[model samples]
Target: MNEQEESNKKQKTSNESTEFLNFDYEFPLDAANVIPPENSSIPEDLFTFVTDINDIAPEPPLEIVTRINSQRQQQQRQRQQQQNKPIVPPNQGVYTIIVGGKPFRLSWESLKSDGPSNFFIEYFKKKKTRVMQIDRDPDIFELIVRHLRGYYIRSTDDIQNQSLLYDATYFGLNRLKKLLQEYSYLNVGGRVFRLPWTLFQKDGTHNFFTGPLMHSLLSPHTEEGNSPPIYIDRDPDIFADIVNHLRGYTIHIRDEMHRKNLLKDAQYYVLRQLSDKLLTAQQTVAGFGEGSNAEVLLLLQDVRIVNMLPPKVTNLSIPNMLISQDWSLTQIQYKRVKDGTPHTLLVQVSDLCMQIHKSAATVKLMYEMNHADIKKMNSMANMAKATRGVNMEIYIDKYCAITIDDNQVKSIEYCMENDLIDTNWEACTKCDLEDCQMSRLILQRAICGVHLVDNMITLCALRLEAISSRFRLNLKREFLSG
Candidate 1:
């Protein structure tokens, strides 16, 4: 119906042989033949054509058809590629996780704990049985301390081994342990696992964190007064996991506390040897009202503080009789006062005995001491300073005059003046040492003795480890029998 159609109609009419006076001398070809074709090499070309676009709607562009077919092929290929790709697996629960093109690390545990706290307690009991087999390998404690320091301290910080670590272990016994334990405070598994990771070591190996930092519990009680027994919430997984984690001791935070505890306890023993009296609470919670509501009370917080930064300097208080009985050493106690009032603290111990003992005394006194002699004692006097106090320098002197610094000589003379003879100090005269051995002294004790003998702590027989082991063995035997 358009102009093109009208033009085509006119063309058709013009080509047809019609009876009309169209034009004079016009060359008209035959209706059936536009071109002369025999074999028709150009048959298609010979025909003058009138064609439509598509069969369905008159005709369509050749390019459009090709484009549609190509699109369909691309979609098919996309499906095939998806099917060919393989999937990657996932790593289980740990510190790290990844998902949806993003990577993340996760370390979490269920806080809502249920069940008898004793189950974990009992499990801890069972796990401690392993300690019985560990012999007194003094090297282990050093390794443990190194391991702990590796994690606990940075080079930027000067970590006081006695102040931060052993102090917590000897807390109630020496009070420092309790002070340190305050920092060990942690919230675990909903149950408020009130543990003294810093102050008390679980059964003495070096694994402090893995050890039961504290039993997740409140004080024992019942709803009614006359009831024989009572109960609280209960779920086994939390207690079980608690048990499992603690029982399977590791050299992580848990075990580190444990070793620190052993050392702390040993430190206390050293104090006791020095004739220090340990203060004990009456356990009657009159001030706190009823049943030791003070269960897990910060027992050693008020415990006195001392200047433990020294070479056998004693700030621990002692009873006169105890001192007379064990005169080889002394204890001077100080009340811990915050803003002047006494902080409810009272325990006695030799500060940092383990760390001090761990150092090489001969090297400390002879070779290392020479470093200090660079000026006063001459070049020949080798000295190495003590790690505890920065200003504390030791040096061996050729003249034996200045090297035996009056301050050092004063301390030695003061102890010797009071009959402080330790037969074990290789540095001391045999007569002086024999006299010390004859007297009741700190060296007469365990780790102190080891310090004098081999320069190490023999923690194999620490009391807490024995107690925990005993508790565990008893529980296991009871469980088996039941």
Candidate 2:
């Protein structure tokens, strides 16, 4: 009875211990992190066969996950609210400013002196002693403080400059506002821009002296911050186009006026590549080819010079003689005309010649009787009319060439890339009357008898008609010459 009873009691106790250790629900196993103690009785192969916890265990129920996330969010919101609470400074002279959930302690005297625009001054007028709270960026507010303390704020980025400017305006910092307007990186016609400083300092391969001129315009902001903008008077829209060109962007000009305006700015700034491009565009618009290769020849025959000045000398007529190309014919009707003023006769001649060299393009040609040459001719005009059948020849290079077709000028070649052809007025003063007279004296030759004709106007008109007909016939042959 004693042995059976003892065995049964022992079995009951072991059963009780096993039942205490076991539960109705299974505890989840973390296979990856689970490690066995060295003295553990568990088999090593049990761990080897273990799978990843995610693979073995299912995720928590959706409601439980949602509730947990909600609790976490609420905790974060509480922390943020605590952080946003206004901070009070301990010192009497210092005031605390809460900005963007950050506290800044500034001197009350400094705020009163430099900051605290009308907004803050009203609060001060109420004599309320409370921490200030602003709904602005704390980083930019620091810049405002720096500016109030008379520190130079060299803002090279447009965004940063704008942020600081907004804060300055809210604070009613008049000095800072003015400085920001003036000392901004670039101010083009009241349009403020803060590009990378290196852009203005950088030299371009296509433009001539662009960087230096633009650089000279933008003065660095001094500690006082009162520097005026260099391009305050310039056109912002055109300047924007220039900026695009500088930034390696292909900018399309909308119309001819825009191109012309930009060209003017480019020329003023000495942007040679841009100017050349615009000039070529101008020629293209005028219906002339990119580069004219045509040559022009002008000839004057049976030339006559007559003096209409008061008779102070022996003769009032110069005989028919070969005249220099530089010698402009004296006005037949007027005693004296201004140099640039269009002479009726010269204008008639130019129009007749242009008609002969007619094309689709507007030919830029001009003929004018020089007043200086007329006066000098008057000095020599008081002489006998010597008749020797004088003839004069004048040549102008590439004056009337028309663009062949649109296909030829599809792509514009910039002058910067190519050598510019010398397109200046060329004249040969070989047959000067004064020089010819001197030569005659040196050679001791007798001059030919003068043939003076009072009705010279009719003869000149007839000669012009003959010359126009000749030009019309030879127009093709003349323009085709290289």
Candidate 3:
């Protein structure tokens, strides 16, 4: 070899050795098969015929095998931990509750904060478990859940309202019960009706259940089960018409008698708007005869008589009187006043007259009382209490009107403000106290009668021509306004 060639060969070998030292090395999974060097003489032909890599490969070291097994075991343990991990993390305040066979995943924080310390909170406090089970109607429970989320339940359906109310009661959610306002069931007569309180409230007729009746309906009963229905003492058939009217449904009026009965029912329930509607309907179809004289249809006969006691009027029993086909008394209550004064008596009668007049606009009521009238009233009452049999002096008035002489009705004082009977007369022998001073009052303006069959009497226009004219005038006014 020349000097320059040998120097190049040495430089090449040095560069290769440097590269091998700088290279990154890692152990391979399969060891490469190596043939024996030229100096080894025993394995040349054997390696030439050997094709399988496993035959030439050496057995792995025990340390490597042990490390591989340990790695597999660690991997298996990690998989088991993943499989056993909880669905809801323990740190998060979340839980799953099954209600009525349906699962609900809800946050404990939401249930605690949103609800008003009610059943949900109380239940969780008592049972501190991650999962809970409650056997209740899921459909109704969904409503309760929404309610807890502060959603206003706008369900106007009477049945749905009743269900929600029942659930709220069952869950001991008082606030939820109040949120569903004015929903109730009424057992009116023998028939049961589901109705909303808003029906009455909407028409501004909530006064129908103002006093004791409303109290009874609202007061809670501790007895287990569904809420008791409110009972109303009224004819179901007639009340059905009222229900229809309130629900904005049209009711077919059969005839004058039907209309009259409906009006009476409306007045009894204090449905002023309904009464007005009935009156308007009647006026629209009213007819009159050719002249002022028309046959009168007397409504009530054989009315039980009640004499109004003088001075301290303990009780003013207003009887159920049907004066004409169009006017009748549906409800009347007489409150006895302990104040034995004529003024108090006058106030009560005035109130009764006003209430009746407000009920039906077609009828007019006027009362008269004087010193002689007071004596006559007391004497009649005394006679009624004393005698069990029929009294000859006590007479029952018929349907026809009776004319009074001028001498009998001396001077008639007209008091405009009082609106009741003129109670400004001198004291009588029976009523000698200062408060028992009697006055003269003329009850009827067009006709006068001593015995009117009952304690109270209502008078309307005697002539049909007058009624027809009045009705026509009202129609004209309404039409013009419209």
Best by lDDT: 3
For model 1, give the RMSD to the true fold. Answer: 26.0
Global fold similarity of model 2 (TM-score): 0.29
For model 2, what is the error of residue 309's alpha carbon versus the real structure, in angstroms, after optimal superposition? 27
Q: Rank the candidates by TM-score, best first.
A: 3, 2, 1
- Report lDDT (CA) for all predictions: 0.27, 0.43, 0.47
TM-score per model over all chains? 0.17, 0.29, 0.37
- TM accuracy, model 1: 0.17
| Model 1: how far residue 114 lies from native, Å | 31
What is the C-alpha local distance difference test score of candidate 2?
0.43
- Say which candidate scores most in TM-score: 3
Lowest summed-lDDT stretch of 10 residues in model 1?
444-453
Clash pairs detected, candidate 2: 319-386, 385-450
Model 2 agreement with the true structure over 330-408: per-residue lDDT tens digits: 3222121112222112111222221111113311121223455334333333432223222111112222111211111
RMSD of each: 26.0, 24.6, 22.3
Candidate 2 differs from the real structure by a C-alpha RMSD in angstroms, to one decimal, of 24.6
Per-residue accuracy of model 1 over 1-482 as CA lDDT, tens digit each: 99999999998765543322222233575644454234333335544555554643755689988998999999999999777644312223222222233333321121001112212222323342211212222332332233322333311111232223332232112232333334333333233333334333332433324232222211112244222111223233333333333344422223534434433433332322111111222221212243321101111221222411111332322221112222112211122211222222112122111110111212211112234222322211111122222222121121121101112232322344454333233332323233222211121111110000011111110110011122333443544363
1 or 2, which is superior by lDDT?
A: 2
Segments of candidate 2 deviating more than 4 angstroms? 1-92, 115-118, 186-482
